[model samples]
Target: MRINVLQHTPNEGPGTIKRWAQQNHHDLYIYHPYQFGVLPTAEETDFLVVLGGPMSPNDSFAWIMKERQLIQTLMEQGKPIFGTCYGAQQIAKTLGYAVTKAPYKEVGWAPVYLQSTVIPGVPPQLMALHWHEEMFEIPREAERLFSSDLVKNQGFILNGNILGLQFHFEPEAEDIREIVINDAEYARHHNALQQSPEEILQMAIPPENRNVMFHLLDFITK
Candidate 1:
């Protein structure tokens, strides 16, 4: 399968998703619209994975708007699509939902409570990395999958093929370090839900996190 990844930043690459693709013997291609202004066509992409970024989906950048249009097009064709953070917001916005500031700027490791068992093997409550100020509204027809203390709409699944996750389950230790270094300002924020850089880095990446990510990937593609 030709899996096309939409990467929005230099640091937020396809961490464990790449590992999953390698293990599953699927080809993975990453495109950076923010840097190159290029995206894969629906015909070239068998599956779509949109990575996280610091940018908001509400931004008026031409690339952002264009990416949303592509997401919409893929949805219309019943192609499998998965998105995280800003990518999730893009999916929601494309589906005519609003992407607005979350009640709190959730950063670092937080617990997300499962609202449904659409994706098997996920624990009832699991810790996931979060680094977004804006949140996507749960789409009209989508089933809400998870929620956190600070954010009500943490994840949603649409039509069994489209998944939107508001937190990071793919980032490894190095990926988290790079994210913290690139967005140091957000890491330093003192908040009830936010964690310090040291804390975020020190917390071990739970084995279940990657396992759950892999399960979701398989579930979406199946």
Candidate 2:
């Protein structure tokens, strides 16, 4: 399958997802739309994977709008799509949901209780990595799948073709360090839900989280 990756920033690439695609021998293409000001058409790839960034979907940037339009087109074509964090916010916005600031920023590792699992391979609960102050409402036609103690809408699935996750399941050890280091100032928020950069960097990534990620990839692509 030809999987197109839409990455928002240099620091926030596809991480382990890229490794999975490579190991699985699927053809993968990447677009840095924030830098290039261009995105791939739905016809160009079999599936779309949108990665996270520090930007908000509500921002009136040309690239952001273009990405949303691309998402809309992909949805109309019934292509499979997966989004994480900022990417998920874009999907929510495309589906007529509002993306707003949460009462607190959520950073570091936390448990996301599974509300329902239509995707088949995920577990009942996941200790996932989250690093966003923004939250999105569940889209009208989507099945709300996960919720966290801090965020009521942690994930959703639109039909069986689209999945949106507010947490990070694709980050490896170095990706975690880069994410924390690049967005260190966000960790300065005094909210109880926010974690210090040092704390974020030192936390041990649970093995089960990676297992969930692998299951999600297979569930989405296969």
- List per-prediction Cα lDDT, in the order shown: 0.92, 0.86
The deviation in Å at residue 168 for candidate 1 is 0.5
Write one digit per residue (lDDT tens) for candidate 1, span 14-133.
999999999999999999999999999888989999999989998899999889889988999999999999989999999999999898888889999999987777899999998988
Q: TM per model?
A: 0.97, 0.95
Q: What's the lDDT for candidate 1?
A: 0.92
Worst 10 residues of 1 by lDDT: 186-195
The weakest ten consecutive residues by lDDT in model 2 span: 186-195
User: Superposing all C-alpha atoms, what RMSD in Å does each candidate have to the true structure?
Assistant: 1.0, 1.3
Off by over 4 Å in 1: none
lDDT of model number 2: 0.86
What count of clashes does model 2 give? 0
